[model samples]
Target: MIIPEQTRNNLEFDKLLKWLSSYAHSSLAKRIILKLEPFDSLENIQTRNKLISQCITLINEEGKYSFHGLANIIPILKKARIEGTYLSSAELYTVYRQCLLYSSIKQYIKQNKAIVPDLYALVEEIYEPSDFMRSIKATISEHGEIFDIASDKLLKIRKEIKEIAASVTTHLESFISDKNNAQLIQEPLVLDRDGRYVLLIKAEKRKEINGIIHGSSASGAAYYCELLSTVELNNKLKVIKEKEKDVCREILQKFTNSIRGIANELIINQRRSAKLDSLHCLATFAIEQGGCMAHFNNSSVLELEEVFHPLLKYKSSMIRKSAIVALSLKLEEPARGLIITGPNMGGKTVALKNIGLAVLMAHSGIPVIARRVSIPYLKALFADIGEKQDLMQNLSTFSSHVQNIIPMLNYSEEGALFIIDELGTGTDPSEGAPLAVAILEHLLFRRGLIITTTHHNAVKIYAESKEELINASMDFDISTLKPTFKIIPGIAGTSHAFDIATKLGVAETIVEKARSIRDKKDEAYLSVLEKLSEQMRDLEIKKEVWWKEKNQLEQKLRMSIEENSEQKKLLLEERRKLSERVKEFLRKSKSRWEEVVQEMKAALSEKAYSEGKQSIKEIEQEAETVLKVSIYQDEEPGQFGVND
Candidate 1:
């Protein structure tokens, strides 16, 4: 879809170019401009015309020293093209003269050591090619003297032209100043190898006023004047041209390196241009919206919400108020297949598209807007969602669906993503459901992610039977009678055929009859022998929960026992520290006692020797009393280590 042309898109593109320029080196940009110098652009009309005129004077004044390279000229040319306004005839002529002068002088300066005109200061450069040619033609026009031009007349005309030529020659110095002199001179002078003058005589010069000199009265005056000037100028031009060539060559050499350096610098400095990022985003959005690159895988699943397609951004605003639906699938036990049943216009098709688009986007490395997006790398994506009916193939929708699906079965990989919309609603559900069920079963065995929307209750039951399959449905608010666009998991709606009809304002009797029929169908499905067995298994889930609870309790008990044991070990360590303190105290007491007892024994023995009385009974009784003091022991378990 083409986005409508708008000011915004144009502005965006301009911004992009500007950003690109930022990364381009100034030198390289110059080279590019030089390459484009010959090309016509806006600048030549307005600014560059003036610049070229001025630059010619400068070049002449400075000789060839100030000359730069064509490499250095490109930027100016580009700027003129992109931003220049307009050029006038006068300005064109000025530029034409300047360019020719520059080109001519460049040659002359090289051959002789002569002073050249200040080319940079000359405003007139090479003007429009057609204008240059026209100017050249104007200088060569011939007019015979009125009723004359015999042999004497030719010699007189030649003499008259030479004097006019000398006068014009002197005016060459004023090429920058004599604007009127430029008008008097015919444009585009032609010169030969010897620089001889060729002139075109005007008839009016023959009628010259007596004793009066008019600018035009001189025959071939402009042509002779330009040639005489050129020959003299050539002397100076020879040296200037040589110097200019050397200067330009040197400048070109330096300019090339600078360009490369600048390019590298810009790339390094502006590598992350916003314009580049924006383009990347746009590309990704396009891929996602266009559903051009989606993939499916086993481990990763994408939960896509209200996703807008990018390709359609310009053509039409995508179904904008579409509700955000949560959708995802993965390869696991219960089932990778989804059975979706809803009324017409319930957005089943849109949902399918959204899923396909989101997958495509994720694989393309683009951002997706979803509450959550977990996508695995998918090997391939196969989808059969749109309408298919072809008389050429003599195939109905059902036949087409089968034809598309049966082949998929052969190539179905374990890591592929598949999207099937309206799986069993194209034909009779009785036959379609069983076929759909068989297909789902086979796909489940392949261990790939599959999402299929079906209208058959039997498919839902089949899904419920397998623990791997999870039932989900698009929510429809019965009051508003609209598909809410919200996908709710694990709840099937029984299609809400009659409920929706009632909300649609159907007659009460008709609604009642429809509900009656729907209920009967629901009852038959619910009461089926296979369904009955599953119901019985579901009712017995409480027993399973009880067993699970018991196992959890035992595990908790074991953890608690381990916690208590750790706590007891901490208490025993505290007791050991107390016992150590008690042992330290006993040791200190014993050391003091030893010192006291030794001193006492020494005094008693000395006194006994002096008094000749041992007093053995008294000494022994005192020792016995000291040793009999009260002693207490710790009440807890004893430790025999150093502290205890």
Candidate 2:
């Protein structure tokens, strides 16, 4: 839940957050996403899952409703306080528009219950008992002006002002157009200044006009003055507007009081709407990028099938024929850890980082990018996967990594997943390997899941020695001297370091000299491990074929039984019709039964159908073709010989 800021940056979680928030329509929704944390309880987590699932179903099946006004009105709801609020007419109109929007959303969801029942429950919270919009509409017009029908006293004053305004305009118009005053007036149009109607008259004729002098124009040649007759009525209209404001204030206060009474309910509704917005955004994101909901279990097991590193997948999308591959891993009670070993750039670090980021994603209630994943309730997920050299703190990468692990392991308990990369590389391998083993032993007693990537032979050996720990490796193709990026479980891996260097244009003589400098026993040990890795890869391929055949056989048996039963029923009907031909039909039925038995035997036998399957060599050849592998030349093929 509390993902360290550094960890977030390491996983590029901020970028992921931005991607998710981009789908959100409201600022409140975006804010909620920014502040997302893991739920406290299993029930709470499941509840969130249910809501998200329903929203996904809604958007994926039926199109989403218009979320236009919802975002605009969210600020008003956020601004509304718990204590009380005296909403202004503009603010009240905001609440009114939200009322209409929610009402429409509710109506739309009503017909889509089959698609989204849980979503409907969220929408139901936003429906109010009172028609808030009706009250707002009755008092205020479309232009935010208070209507005359709002109050009788206000209406009477406005009517009287209108009649007085007409009388003032008539007098002003007649005086301006007259031939006697034609030279006196600047223009015939009358202008209203501060609620008083005035005429722009010639400065020389200003004294002649029978009007009270108000003000003179900029040129000082003409005067802008109000007539003596309209002054008293202008005063009346000003007083009436004040009264109208008081009346409007009283109406708004009463409206605010009504809102305050339902303030608690409104807040709850506001929260629900925010929740719905979040669901909508997540659902849309999931649909956009193929993502699956994770399954939960009571058992303390970690399983991931076909899981993609989300950020990596996004990056791979930029290139044509993207080369990013998904990862699959599992750790149950019996196997607490796995040591991933391979040549350089074999994706060992990526695999470790991938697991850590994905667990964090799931922990924070986000749908992970996987075809299928099942995880138990984890206390936490601890990761020490990347380079953490701190120059400011004067810490080397090894010391930084050690500092992280020491404290994490001190407080670590059962039900946590710990991931580390390059476990014994940054320090002396002699001491680091033993230290890593010690750490693993300590974590094992705690019953936590531990996974680490290493090129250390000692680490791989230690892993193989423990039943609780397993060894896995990212496969490197020997012929091409390129990493295959395939994880081969339960097998130790060779570094394949010198081979890669030679392929990358290091002189063959220099590579051979480096290999010879290594202890012969170590060389023999690594060569054995490399052979074992290859054997394990072949075994894995065979195991897959075996499982595939088993599943197919089971399916065939099931279908055969069903079809056989149906055929027996039809034959029984025929037997009932022809008593004379029963024996002949029985003979034919026996022959058909023999054929079915033979077919079943052939389908079940391993050797009988194995011939039709392609050899592992052919599979590898095709894979090499697809990858366009470059095979480096060797001085002596299949022999680990040194060149002079």
Choose the strongest candidate by lDDT.
2
Pairs that clash in candidate 2? none
Top model number, TM-score: 2
Evaluate model 2: give its TM-score: 0.76
**In model 2, where do residues sit more than 4 Å from their true spots?**
1-9, 71-86, 110-127, 169-192, 198-229, 316-323, 476-485, 532-644
**lDDT of candidate 1 over 1-644, digit per residue (tens):** 11112211311323323332332333343222222211122233223323322333333454323122112222322322332232222332333343343344334333332332232222123222344334423422223111112224334544554564455445444552456434343443432223333332223332321111223324544223223434544444444445544443343333233333333322322222221222223333333333222232335455454454332332244456433444443334435555665556676666666666555445433334343455555555667776777799899999988877765577546656667877765788789989988888787787666777877877876675665566566655566777755554443434656667777788999877765776554654433322222222332343344345444433443344436646544544544454354346445644544444344334333442222122223332333332222222335433111110
Candidate 2 per-residue lDDT over residues 442-530, each given as its tens digit: 88888888888887777776775677887878887766876666677656677788988877899999998998799765775675566
Question: Candidate 1 — worst ten consecutive residues by lDDT sum?
Answer: 1-10
Off by over 4 Å in 1: 1-231, 234-333, 375-377, 390-395, 497-519, 523-644
Error of 1 at 557 (Å): 32
lDDT of 1 at 105: 38
